[model samples]
Every structure is written in C-alpha cells, then in structure tokens.
Target: MVKSHRKDSVDAMKNAAEILAVDSEIISRERNKIEQAKYNLNQLNNLLDDSIDDEIDFLEQLENSLKNPGDFKNSLLLEKLEIIGSRQIPNLEGISLIDSMEISYDWKEAVRLNQEYAKAYQIDLKHPFIAMFSSIELVEISKQVVEEFELLELDKLDYAFAASAGLIAGFIDAIFVGSIKSRADATGLQKSVDKAFDKIVELYGKHERIAELTNQQEKAKTDSSKQNIQNSIDKVKAGIVSASKNGKIVEREWTKHDSIKWLEKYKKVGYDAATNLKDGSFHIPGMSPDNHHLLSLAHEPSLFGLLIGIVDQITGKSTFIGNDGMIQRIVTDNVNKELSGNMVTQITQACENWFGHIMSDIAGSSGSKGRGSGLPVPGWAALQKLQFGHINYSERHSDVTIAELSELMFKKGYDVRSFSAQLIPVLVYETLLRCYWFYKQHFYYGKDLKESVPIANNRELARLLLISAGSFSTVDVTHAIIKSVPGSPQFIAEFIMTVNLPGLVDLGFRSFQNIRNEVSHRKHMENIYENDILIEYNRVMSDPSVL
Candidate 1:
C-alpha cells in the first residue's frame, strides 16, 4: 500500500510541475503582447506629432503669403486652406496668442504706438507714411521733440507744442527722404508717401479750425501745426493696434463693397474688442530682465542719439515754413529738392535703431519682479536707496531727493505718460506693488519692527501668514491698518497678522491713480494736480512704522 501511495504522489508532483510550466509560457506571451502594444502606441504618437508639425508649417507659409503687398489675390487658395483647417487642424487662437507674446518688445511697442498714431490722426495704419514709421521711429521723434523744445528754451509748459511740432516735422521729413529719390524724381513708393502726407496735412488743418473756435493765444496756423504733432503720435498708437490686430487675419481679396462692409461691421462691434485680444500692456516678455543692474544695462537709452546723429549727417539743407514757426524745417529736410545717399535705407536704419532703443527702455523700466522684495525698484538707484538708506528712510526727503525718486519711479520706472490707456492700470499696479514692498520692508522688516516681515508675492500668502498666528476678523485688521494709525503692540501684532493685504496693495497703487487717470484720458499736464497725491504719498511713504 505504501509503495502505491508514493507512486501516486510522484505522478501528482509531475503533473503540478507541467501545469506551472504551461502557466509561465502563457504569462510570457501576454507580456510580449503588452510590449508590442506600447511600441505601437509610441510609433503612432510620433506619426501624429510629425503630421501636426507639417500642417503647422504649411499653415505658416500660407499666412505669410497672404500678407504680401502686391496685387495678386488667392481666393481659391484661401478657401482650400480654410477647408483643410476646418477639417483637420486645431483652433489657432492660442497659437497666435503665443506668437504675439513671443514677439520682441520693440515690435510690441511699435504696434501699440501705431494704434495710438492711427486713432489720433483718424487714419489707417496701411497708409504709406504711417506704415513706414514703426514704434522706434516714434521714440526718435519724441526724443527729437523734447530736445528741440529744450533748444528753444521754451517754458516747460510749452513742451507739448515742441513735441507736436517735432513729430510733424519728423514724419514729413521721413516721407520726403523715404519716397523722393532725387530732385523731381519719385520712387514707386512716393505715391503712398504723398497720399499719407496729404492726409496728415488735412488733419493738421482741422486743428487750425479748432484753435479758431477755442480762441487760444496761439495762432490758428501755429496751433494746427502743434495739433498735427499730437495727431502724429496718436497715429502711431493707432497704427500699432491696427497692425497687431490685423496681422494674423488672412488677407482676402476684397471688393470695395466688401471693404466698406468690413469697416461697418468693425464700427458696430467696436475696434477695441478686436484689437485688444490680450492684456493691453505694451510689454515684451523675453526682452525684459528682473534684476535692477541687468535692466539698467539692457535699456541704456540705446541708438536714439546715434540715429539722430546719422539723420542729421545725411540730411541736406532745405526748409519749409511750419505752423508754430519755420522751425518745422529743422526736422523736415527738402528731400524733393535736396539730400543725397540712400535716404530710404537711412530712414529704415534709423527706425530699426529706435526700435532697439525702445526695447532696451522697456527692459529696464518694466519686468517681472525677482528676489529682494519681489518688486521692481527704479534700477540701481532705488536699489541703492533700499540697501544703504542713501535717501534716509525715516526723515522727510529733500525736494531734490523727491524729484529724483519721482523721475525714477514715474518717468523712467513706469513710462507713465507714453503708453496707451490700456496699459495705465498695469503700470499703476506695478508701481503700487513696488511701493507696498518698500512699505513692508521699511516698517515690518527693518530694525524698528517687533515681528519678522511676512514674505509674500500675492495677497493670499499675506492672509495665510495672519490666519496661522491667531484668530482675527478681516474688518478689524483693515480698520486698524488703513483707517487709523497702526499703534499698540497688540494692535500692531493683530494688524501685522490680519491687515487687508489687497486693500493695502490697492492703497499703495492709489498714489498713482490721479496720474494714471489723467494720462489715460489724454488730459493736459496743467490739469494734473501735482501736490495732492504726491504730498499724501510722501507722507505715507516717509515711514509706514508710524502708521
């Protein structure tokens, strides 16, 4: 019986071993199938990626072809492309936004200034002279205008007149040099330039009419010229907006009626919605630097002087009597009769250089904040003031000191008056953020403070820090910090813990509200109340510890 049981056990063991081997083989086959599936999936993914890339490349080429200036129309091509896009391609709005974001700062500014220019002159950007002058050219004209006003020793009040005069002169000169080749000879481009010039002149004439109506001290002729100068700037702004807005839209062959209908549609819908597809700040992302030292180096008032000098050198003497004075002759050369060399190329080069200068300026003036308060300081000067207390943090600042800081913060730091209304809020917010950093660092973090400064970039971090310490109501914290002076150790502690970070931030930004409002509305400097806000700001910024 024992011998029979042993034989059965051996047979059972043999069957079990065979069953385990079969199971192992089945598992191996399944693993192979899984590996093959993954490989196939990866291969399919790569193929899809390649196909998408090819489609995008083809689309890019088509877009470029559509923008070409000649009379060729591709109605069938556009239709075919649209059909293919609708069938196979993804929505390109995000892609276009990314492309806009990636554009150079100079390009962005040029677009913005073009919009302003267009709206000011009530002209389209496609008009020849308007097309010629990009963002950099506007900066050059602005610089020239300011310099000319300085040379005239005009009262600072008359600087606006100088600027306007300078702009008209510059535009007319650019048109002449750009379009007229030699005496009595005109390039094919000349017609567009002439048309643009006539339009500008007509617009300028309107200012004379307005001046007559208002009965201002300036003569109608002078006022018209001055008004034309402003109109030129407005044209630049408008041109920028128009270009950026229309740049991506595939140009289709349009009948006169089609064009009129398109304009009517835009009028009804409003151009603002179409043009301002993104936040309207004239900021170029990749060009700007967060570091103060780097920013200063980056933006260093590039090429404005060089371009001016070059234009001056190449320009031949020819003067035309202008509205304000024969002074318009200073900027406008008689390219129709005089001036030599490739004036077109020279003007082009000048525009390019000016664009570079504007980029550098944008880099220095505005950028993402970094360490050291996570707020933009007015370059190295403000940094110095922050680090070493060169401007005495506790005491009342001298007029000179205040002026310096004001220039640094308002003029160089923010480019307050130069930008579009859409960008005012952005500039104002940034300025306030910087001010908040200054307030916190001086009062909360400096040696006088009883508690350590709360490190925060946004308001939520501030709230979190307060809530973690103890129970507190938002209302109590806001009242203690803003409505009344910050005092009493317990109240200070609570205020430190519970103050409305957003409100405080808003208050800091509020200092620039008046200036922003004035600039946004295109109000004159005389209308701006210099003392009211500045005085309050000075008191608040002098020392937040007292508050």
Candidate 2:
C-alpha cells in the first residue's frame, strides 16, 4: 500500500512539473507577442519615411527625364533591348519602379479603397500614409513639367500631354486634399478632445488641488512620500505638456480647412479636343484602353466613383476617380508583427487625421496665375456633404446581428451605439463581466453545493478570484471567472441581464464598469466570436434603447 501511494505521489509531481512548463511557455509567448507588436509599430514608421523618400526621388528623376526626352527614351530603349537579349523581362526578377501612368492609376485606386474602408471602420482615411503621398508627388512632378516645358516649342501631341498631365495633377491634388480635411474635421476623436477643454478649465481653476499637493510635498519626511510627491508633480507637468501639444496639432489640422480656397481659382487649361483619343493622339506605348476610359470619365466630377472602378482594374489596385491613379507602395517585410493595443487605437485616430489632411490638401485648389476656366473645382463643403453621404450609406447598409448588439454594450463609451462597426471590444468585455459575476454568485456566494453547478474542487481559489475581480486588469478577472466556471454557459440567455431581476441587473452593472476599465486601458479580447454569445445577449437586451 505504501509503495503504491509513493508511486501515485511521483506521478502527481511529474504532472505538476509539466503544468508549470506549459504556464511558463504561455508567459514567454505573450511577452514575445508584445515585443513583436512594438517592433512592427517602429518598422511601419521607418518604412513610410523610406517610401516617401523613394517617391520623391522618382519624381525628381521623372522631371529630369522630361527635360531631355530624346536621351531618356534612347536609354530606356537600350535597357529594354539589353534585358530582351538576355532573355529576361525587365520586371521579372524583382520589384521595379512604376512608370508615370502606372503611378497615376495606383494613386486613384488607393484613394477609392481608402474611402470605401474608412466608412466601414467608423474612421476617415484608411489608406496607408505612404500611398496618400502619391498625390503630392504627382502634383510636384506636374508643376515641374509645366514650369520647364510649357513654353518650349514642342510637338503638338507632346505639349498637350505634358500640359494635360499638369492640369490633371492639379485637379486631382485638390480633390485629395479636400477629402482629407473634411474627414479629419468629422472624426469621433473630437468627442474625446472636448474633454481637453474641460482639462484646460481644471488647470486654470483655483489651486485647492495644487495647494493640497504642495502641502503633502512639504510634509513628506520619508523616502516613499517624497517619491510620491515627485511622481504627482511629474504627472501634472506631463498632462499640461500633452494638452499643449494636442492643442497645437489640432490648430495645425483645422487651419488647412482654408485649403478649399484653392478651388475658387481653379482651371483646366489646354485644348478641349485633347480629352478625346481620336481628335488628339496622346497615346503613350504602355497606356491601355482602360486607361483611356479612366481619362474619359474624368470630365465629370460626380463620376469620380465610376472612374475609380475602371482605373482600379488597370492599376490592379483600388481607384478613387474615373482616371487611373497610382500610389506609392509599402514594403511589408518587417510589418508582420502584431500591433500593441495602444498602437491600434493610436493608428486608428492618427490615420483618420493624417488621411483627412492629405485628402483636403489634394482637393484644395491652388491660386495660380495660369488657372484654367474649364471645370468647376469641388469645394470643401461639397466634399464634406459627400463624406456625410458615405457615412449614412455605411450605417444604413450595415447588417446588425445579435453578436454585434451584445458586443456594442462593452465598448469604451456608451456612445458606441452610434457606430455599428465599433462594437466588438465592448461585447468581449460584457462577456467577461457577465461570466465573472455569474461564477461568483453561483459558485462562490451560494451555500448549497448540489444546487449550484459543480466547478473545480477548490475553495481558496474562489477567494483569490474574488480578490482578483477587484483588480485593475480585466483580463485577470476574466481568466479567474473562466477558471471558476469550468462548465460555463454557452448561451447568452444563461447569463445575460434580465429586466425583472434587479439584483442580477445590478451585478451586470458592476461587471459593465469593470469592462469599461479594461477598454479605457486598451485591454483587448484574445479570441473573437461572430454569432454565438451575441445570440444569447440579444434575447436579454431586447430593447434597442437599452443597448
């Protein structure tokens, strides 16, 4: 009997060791995930900067090439022959620089995709930052072309092409800039920013708070107390600095709203016959039929969406207007890292503002001396109406499921009901809270063991869970709840808040607070479900107003 008992003890010891190893591995993996996310954030910034530099270089080269067209064409032809002689296509081996037409196609597509995704994501300007800069580069290139070759005695076709390129670039730039600024001004972040004004009020308030802190600092006789005072002061100083910086960024962004003035002096110079392929032969060798279609559609400003669709096909990317537009490319080698939670929120907010400003700048008309009186430039107000129309389209078209409804309850703010796409994190938080509360009430607080559902054979674990429930980390509380209810309910009805049960509803309210804490701190859900718990959630919060 003793020998048998000793053998059982040895097996238990081995099992415990294995469990420890598994836990250690999990911790290591999480740490690596966090580190990788940080690495990706840094790499994204560096990559954007690098891509912008390359784009600038290409524009400079293109400008130079246009100045000496004969030499440039001869060199390109020679290079092409050399590659063909070697039995290798020019673009077969590696990434190659896209030509002017290709760039134009890509820029349009990027803008189109950006508009489509931005609405879906409840944010503005979803395109990659580097991609947006393509408009700026195109405009710069066109300006250079116009400056150098506008006066030169060139062939009719060549001069028309060059002049058209400049005029087209100018018009497109105005559209891009206008779109960006409108989007930025209409962000949900402005709600958060309203608190900045409140903060300013607090800072200017009489120093009862400051006096209390100063008194505490003077009375601090111990190392810990002195350290505490220094920390408090540092926090105060940091908040002030952050408020000041944020104010400056806001000012800079809004001042560009005046960019719409660019439209007031807009013009489309050159021959009206230049728009047609038959009347004016402006065909470059690499340009396709789809490219011509895109250009043809550019005559009407309202058909920009249709233009984007045609251009998107040729560019093999998304497009904005009917003309084939090209954007800068992003190198994604080091960007595979998982994003940190804070980084995700920052990216969401910053991209909206960044893209908004860019689109605004693009659409902003320049007050140039050579303004053509061909077509009317769409002003910032018109662009804003377009954006509002898109937003309404998204809201109306979005399909709301039980899962989406449930998820909506746990978002960082109660205002999430306004945007259907912003519902997931809130849903996960609600699940965590409900699960924790149910586990606590039935498993911990309940007296009758048989009446309550059976869980792990541990009492101290319940105590620890209760204590941890009060912790700042919702994830920890969630884990504790999951552990306590080993046989957790699969359906939302099993745990969702009910109208008649005031006591149960109160518990839900407390849990909801916990969820809010987690979201505000950028804590996120590990796993996602689309239609499962949400069905259960819908059964309980049947009232739309309650959600």
Candidate 3:
C-alpha cells in the first residue's frame, strides 16, 4: 500500500510540471504577437505622418499661389508633375486627370475656399484674432491689411481745388492780418490780454495797487511839465517799491539809481538779479531790460519756467541762458531772510508771488512810456539762444545774428498779442482747405457728411493741409519781400512786421513730420510685402484645425 501511494504522488508531480511548461509556451506566443502588432502600428503611424507632411506642403504651395496670382500657372504645373510622378504610370489616364484639373484662377472660388477654410479652422480672416493674449502684437499682419485697403485715393482735381482754396486764403491773410504796432493798435487779442491781466489782478486782490498807479498816471497826464511829470513818476515808483516790499523780512535799502527797485521784495523771497542793464551785474549774456523777459529762463511764461522761477526765489539764485546756448545759474544775493513755512506752504506762496509778479510785468511798469516790454510768447526765448544766421539790419550794423534779430522783433512789438495776430492767416488757410475738402468729398465724391469731415489724421486732408500751408507761406514770404526793401527807411518795420516767422516755422515742422510719417509708412508696407507668405503660413498654422 505504501509503494502504490508513492507512485501516485510522482505521477501527479510530473503532470503538474508538463502543465506549467505548456502555460509558459502559450504566454511566450501571446507576447510575440503583441510585439509584432506594436511594430505594425508604429509603421502605420510613420506612413500617416509622411502623408500628412506632404499634404501640408501641398496646401502651403496652394496658399502661395493664391497670394501671388502671377505665379499660379507655374505652381499648378508643379503640382501636376508631383501628382503624375506619384502615379505608377505616366499614361493617358494620369495625363487626362491632370488636364481635367481646373487651371484658371477664379476670384469667387478662391474667396469661397478661403471662407470655408476659415470656418473649418475656426478663424475670422476679415478680423483675425491671431494672438492668444492681447499684448502679442502682429504688426506685420496689421500693416499688410492697412496697405491693402487704407490707401489715400485723391485725384488731380482734388489737389487743384486744395491749392486754389489755399491761394484765396493766403491773399485774405496778407490783406486782413497785418502787424500789431502797439497795445492801443492791437487787434482783439490785446484787449483780451488787458481784460485777463485786470481779472488776474482783481482775483489776487492787487486792484488797490493798480488803482494807485492809475491815479499817479492820471495826475502826471494833468500836469504836462517835465519837472512835475518826473515828480509824479518818482512818487509812482516809490509807491510801487513800498507796496512790493515784504514786511515779514528785513528790507534792504536801494539807491535812486536802482531802476528795478520795485522788484526788490516782489516774491517775499528774492527774484531780482540785475538792478540795471548798464551794470555788468546781470549774469545772462546779451541781456537788456527791454529783452530780459525773453533771455531769462526764470521769467518765461510757462509751467516749466514757473517752477524754475520758484526755485530761484527760494534759493536766491538766477537762472539764464549763457552765451554758449546752455543754462547757467548764479547767486542773486537778494533773499533778505529765509521764508517761514513748510515746503507745501512755501510752494503755494511762491505760486502766488509768481502770478502777482507776472501780472505786474505782463502789462508795463508804471514808469514805462510806450507799449512797455511785455512778456514774450511762451517759446520765443528758445530762438534767442540759437544765435545762428546773419541779417543786415542796416549799413552801419551789417551782420546781426538771428539771436539779435529775435530781440529786435520783440523790441518792435512782436509780443504774445502779435503772435495771435499772426495766427489769423493760418486760421484762414485751414478753414478754406477744410471747407473745400468737405464740399468736394460730400458733393462730387458723394461721400457722407460725417466721412467728409476734414479730420487731421485723414491722409487726404493732411496732404491738402501741407499743400495749402505751403502756398499760404509762399504768399506771406512774397509780402515780406515786397514790403521790406534793403536800404529803405521802412525796412526794419516791414521785415519784422510782415514776415510771419511763426507760420513759416510751423509749416517747416509739419512738412518734416509728414515726410517722416510717409517714409515710415512705406517701410512698414514693404516689410509686410516681403514676408506676406510667411505671415499667412504662420497664421494658418496657428489655427486649431491645422494643429
């Protein structure tokens, strides 16, 4: 019985070993099948990738052909060759297939295809959103679109009309807008300045001071004797000095020779630098009492000048343009004591002082006889520092620099009010150009009134303005030449009065800007054209469908 049990166990163990071997064989076969399947799948994937790449290349060629119609025939021929080469035989069937393919470039079909492609690829070709973020700029694409559509399409007739209008306007400007000789002879502009000066004085509660000066003037007029007039002038000067003094600080006594004593304590802090023009104490080169307002940067009627003037008042320093056309600073030796306030309060006080001082200087001082050297136009001082060019004022002084000419202009009453008078011609030219542009665009071109509005940025309108301004400036130049003859008695007067220097400067600046803009625009357009195909490819590739 023991031997039989052992035999059964041995047989059972052998059967188990055989069963394990069979299972191992089956598992090895299954693993080999999986490996083979994976290899086949990889091969299929590679074939699909190559096909997709070929298709993409073909699509790119097609897109290029669409962009450049001139190359369409050559591109289509190449595509035909490719298709025929891919075929097993270059026989009649393949030739017929190539022949059957549409070769003609049809705009309607092209547009339809583009629309379908855009729709499928979830793109709007008309208003393409090429960026994932707003900051990502497609400058080339934008330029391409603008070049394709936003062209200025004005005709010869339009330009003719613009020129005619400008000529008429120029004539009007020469006749109506002459020169301002004095405040009393000033156009509406001087009256406006007077009213503003009066209002500013009233607002600052300095009317009493002005009233007293007026009273002094009235008394002087009543008594025309030279001695009596001198007395009244001396009293007026004394009153102005007394009124201008800051009582909070110790006063510095000035002599009768000090002409600018009225400005001794004008700002509570120090502002006056030169007591008189004859003395070398005035630091600014070529500065005179008549043209000091133009030479001194601190006295400029601008916010930047105001700030500089305030600093001068606080620090007891005077800032002016040097002989070398650079800024120079010097100690004033005028501040009697330190101002009593925090920085903010001091600044506020400085502003008040600046306004009051400007009012006193804007008109004339009580001692002034004529138009009184008023404040220059805001940027007029800058021209004085540009001491280039030579003008023959007279045979005695044959070579006067442009800087001297600027000063002469100021001395001859070319103040801010005069600058305003100069604008009339410019305004007339602009108005005429705009009206003609609108009339032509609306009536002849049949454009809407809104579209016909002559906005500055409109290329057509800008071109018209440039041409018109040129014509107007030409007439102004002619007027100046006709009026100002060399060696004539009226040469100085006519030269300064008739020549619209400001208008000429404005024209030159605008012309430069226009040319620069046109050049830049052309460069951008060229760049867009150079990379048009690449830009389109990139845009198409970015589409979700292409990905």
List all candidate RMSDs to the true structure.
Answer: 40.8, 44.2, 26.5
lDDT of 2 by residue, 70-139 (tens): 6665565455445434542122222223211111134346444434433443432322322233456657
In Å, residue 502's CA in model 1 sits off its true spot by 18
* Model 3 regions more than 4 Å off: 1-149, 156-161, 180-269, 273-280, 322-326, 333-340, 431-455, 486-493, 533-547
Count clashing residue pairs in model 3.
0
> What does candidate 3's lDDT look like per residue over 142-190, in tens digits?
5665557466777797788767766776676567665556645654444
What tens digits encode model 1's per-residue C-alpha lDDT throughout 1-547?
9679656545433433333333343354456666766766776677678677757766666676678736435764566566555654332211111101122245346445444544553443333333344467768876775544322222442333323332332233233222112112333333333233334433333333233334432444676676765554354333321222445734232222222222222222111111222453422221122222222221223343334334433563212111111122133232222223487875665444333223222322112221011112223222222322133212233232432332233222222111111122223323433344445556654734323233433232232222221121233243445533444333332333223333334334443453354354344332232444345445643664732
User: RMSD (Cα, Å) of candidate 1?
Assistant: 40.8
* lDDT ranking from best candidate downward: 3, 1, 2
The candidate that achieves the highest lDDT relative to the unseen native structure: 3
Clashes of 1: 25
Per-model TM-score, in order, reads: 0.16, 0.14, 0.54
